[model samples]
Target chain A: DAGVTQSPTHLIKTRGQQVTLRCSPKSGHDTVSWYQQALGQGPQFIFQYYEEEERQRGNFPDRFSGHQFPNYSSELNVNALLLGDSALYLCASSSTGGGDEKLFFGSGTQLSVL
Target chain B: LAKTTQPISMDSYEGQEVNITCSHNNIATNDYITWYQQFPSQGPRFIIQGYKTKVTNEVASLFIPADRKSSTLSLPRVSLSDTAVYYCLVAPGNRKLIWGLGTSLAVNP
Candidate 1:
């Protein structure tokens, strides 16, 4: 089966610019979550989308938002980007019912905020 | 969310077994211990998970003590390809996983 897939492996954006990163969850999975990893740091939770609605969120700001399409694909949008926004944007997919909620991650999109 | 603490970095020779331990003193009753491995530019991949006692898998082994305050990830016969950052996370059911800095393991030739 295909694993979690993300688009635009690498991206460049200037300050105040907006960017959107896409993700397609693994087949048979329905929940999508986003995370950000800075240099020399572990991935930080951004938010999670289930049933086309944001179910839980982390400490990130409003500029960071996400959407889960009906097809289970997800998009992470960050507005008014700052240089500090530069990091690796990761998408993880998991299912909610039945089995354990083990997450499968994508290769991630590297966001470079200039 | 339970807070996790692990080593900043570790080094092991090829063919040697490596054990990385993580501490989560405030771990709740419902939380589960999960480990993830990450390469230089890739997303974290789930390694193994356990709640209590020991759990072994093809790639690695997880040991959770009865107290559940700490867990260890053991990788046997390490190779250069085994080098990566290992994260210890605590999640309550299907909630957001809390990630710590993680232990950076380097397997040398």
Candidate 2:
């Protein structure tokens, strides 16, 4: 089975612009979550989507939002990007069944806000 | 969400086993401990997870004591390729995971 996959492995955006990153979850998974990893730091939770609705969210601002399509694919959008928004945007997928939520991650999209 | 704390860096020889411990003093009874390894420019990969006692898998082993306040990830027979950042996370089932700055392990030859 193909693992999680993300689109536009690398992206460049200028301040005050908007950018969207896409993610195709692993086969047989339904829940998708997004994370932001800054240089030399651990990933910061952004939000999680389940059943086409946002179920959980972190401390991110309103400028960061996400959507989960019917096919279980997801898109993360960042509006009014700031220079500090430059980081690796990671997409992780997990199953809500079996009571154990182990995440399968995709090679993240590197976002650079100039 | 229970916060996790791990060492900043660790070093070991190629043939030696490596054990990295994580502390979560405020862990909840329903929370489970999970570990992930990440290489530069790549997303983190699942290593092993456990609720109590021990859980062993092909890649590594996870040990959790009865108190469940702490856990250890053991990688056997380390090699240079094992050099990466190891993250320790604690979260309940179906809940969002909380991540801390992980342990950077460097396996030397």
Candidate 3:
């Protein structure tokens, strides 16, 4: 079975521009979460989507938003991108059954903001 | 949410066993300790997780004491490919989590 996959392994955008990244959840998974990792830092939570609704979000600005499709795929959108928005965006998927289920992450999308 | 603390870096030779410990002094009663391994420019991979006691998997082992305030990730006979950043995080009471800075392991020849 294929694992979590993300699109456009790398992307480049300029300040005030917008970018959209996509993610396909692992087979048999329903929950999708997004994270942002800067150079030399750990991944930080962005938001989580379940049943086509946003569940939780981190401290990210309103410029960051996301949506989960009926098939459990997800899209992360960042508007008015700033220089600091450049980072690796990771998509993770997990099931909610095993209360302690671990998240499976995709290779990540490297976003470069100029 | 429980806050985790791990070392900044560690160094060991190949064929040696490496143990990275994490401290979460305020761990909640229902929190579980989980570890993830990440390589440069790649997303993290789950290593092992535990609530209490020792849980061993094919790749690694997680040791959580009864107090549940700290845990250790032990990699036996580590190889060069094992060089990566290891993160320890607490699956909080609300099921939300925040990853710590993580420990960087450098396996030498």
Candidate 4:
């Protein structure tokens, strides 16, 4: 079975520019979540998607948005990116079973904002 | 969401057991303790999880006391590859989880 997959392992962007990252859920998984990890820090939750609708969001700005396709794939869009936006964007997937299910994470896309 | 606290860093030699403890003083009754391991520039991987008592897996073991306010992740027979950051998370029904600076374990030869 395939694990979670993410596109654009690394990216470079300037301030005020927009970047889009993609994620494919693991086999037999339906839920997708996004996280951001800065240098020397743990990951912070961005949001979660289920049933093609956003279920819960973290304390992120409106510039950060996402979409979940019919096949359970996800896209994370960051607009007006700032220098601080440069970090590792991680995509995690889990099933729709009990809430305690473990999450499988992708290697993540390294975003660099200039 | 319950908050978790772990050590900043630890050093252990190979062939010895390493235990990383996490404290969640305000853990809810329904909250469960989970652990994740992450190497440099890589995504975190699930190590083990438990609600109470002891749960052992192939890679690690999770020990949660009856109070449920704290837990420990024990790695037996550590090696250089076992050097990574370990996170402890407490989630009730797996809602919005808050991750803190995890404990960084460095296994030496």
Candidate 5:
């Protein structure tokens, strides 16, 4: 029973550069969501993916996008990154069938934009 | 999405019980209260959740009033390992969760 897993534990990039982070949801889970957390702050929702389509998005700009594969794995892509984009990118997974919707999260990818 | 308000920080000694309350005045009828705890470099972990009344797990207990406007997370017997930021979220089933600053709990020896 593997829990959610994310790749590229840490990344460094410059302004205007792009970065891609990956996530594999927990077993038996279908929905995947991404969040961004700055130092000493709660996570901010980036978007959610279900059935290979983005279902919900937060206040993030268009520079942030994501993809969900058939296997329920996900990828978060940020283009034209700014210095402010430096933060911890978290991946959370949940099962849509269950009414409770308790999420399981991965350790997250730390992105540093210079 | 209803906004949640919790204490910015709390301090307590080990072997004492700690209770952190969260207020969500605009909570909807279908909304449920969920709590999470996070360490310095790790993702948030689910502690407990409840719709109304009380829900208790091995880690903590969640108490939701009948009005559903506020809830309290009770952690029994504090320990230094329990020091972390606790988040309270309110959302309907299957809806995106909205997060606030969360309450930072510091357990002292």
Candidate 6:
């Protein structure tokens, strides 16, 4: 079975621009979560979506938003982006049937804000 | 502060066992410890998780102490492909939104 997949593998945009990143969850997965990892640091939570609704969000600002389609694919949008927004944007897939669920991740989109 | 503290990085040779430990002194009552592996520019892949005691799976074994305050990830006979960052995360509540710094593991050929 194919694992999770992300688009554009890498992206480049100017400061104050807007960018959209997409993720397709793994097969048989229902929940999707997004994360951001700066250089030499750990991945930070952005938000999680289940049943086409955002269930929880992290400490990121409003400029960061996401949507989960009925098909379980997700999109993360950043508006008026700053240089700091450049990082590895990760997408994780998980199942909800069990109380303690594990996530399967996709090779993230490497966003570079110039 | 997160509930876990692990090493920044570790080194291992091919066919050698690699063990990475994390410390979580203030783990939540309902929290479970999870470990993830990430290659460069890739998302974190879940390795294993356990609440307490020990849990073993096909790929790796997770050893959690009785106190639930710490956990270890043991990889048997690692290879160069195992050179990646390993993250330890704590999910304490109904929602699993907590993610922190993961340990970096470098496996030499």
| lDDT of candidate 5 over A13-69, digit per residue (tens) | 999999999999999999999999999888999999999999999999999999999
Candidate 1 regions with alpha-carbon error over 4 angstroms: none
**Measured by C-alpha RMSD in angstroms, how accurate is candidate 4?**
0.7
Docking class of 1: medium
lDDT of 6 by residue, A26-61 (tens): 999999989898988887889999999999988999
Top candidate on TM-score is 4
State, as a TM-score between 0 and 1, how close model 2 is to the true structure.
0.98
Where is model 2 chain B poorest over a 10-residue stretch in terms of lDDT? B91-100
Worst 10 residues of 4 chain B by lDDT: B90-99
Candidate 3 residue pairs that clash: none
Q: For candidate 3, what is the DockQ-based docking class?
A: medium
True interface contacts retained by model 4: 0.60
The DockQ for candidate 4, computed on C-alphas, is 0.73
True contacts kept of each: 0.60, 0.67, 0.42, 0.60, 0.56, 0.54
Selected candidate, larger lDDT, 5 vs 6: 5
Question: Distance from true position, residue B64, model 3, in Å?
Answer: 1.1
Across A8-113, the per-residue lDDT of candidate 1 in tens digits comes to 9999999999999999999999999999999998888999999999999999999999999999999999999999999999999999874257889999999998
Q: Which segments of model 4 are wrong by more than 4 Å?
A: none
TM-score of chain B of 2: 0.96
The sequence of per-residue lDDT tens digits that candidate 2 reaches over residues B1-102 is: 888989999999999999999999999887888899999999999998889999999989999988999999999999999999999998886456778789
CA lDDT scores, all candidates in order: 0.92, 0.93, 0.91, 0.93, 0.93, 0.86
Q: Across residues A1-114, which tens digit of lDDT does each residue of candidate 4 receive?
A: 889999999999999999999999999999999999999999999999999999999999999999999999999999999999999999999987775878889999999998
Candidate 2's residue-wise lDDT over A16-100, tens digit each? 9999999999999999999999999999889999999999999999999999999999999999999999999999999987656
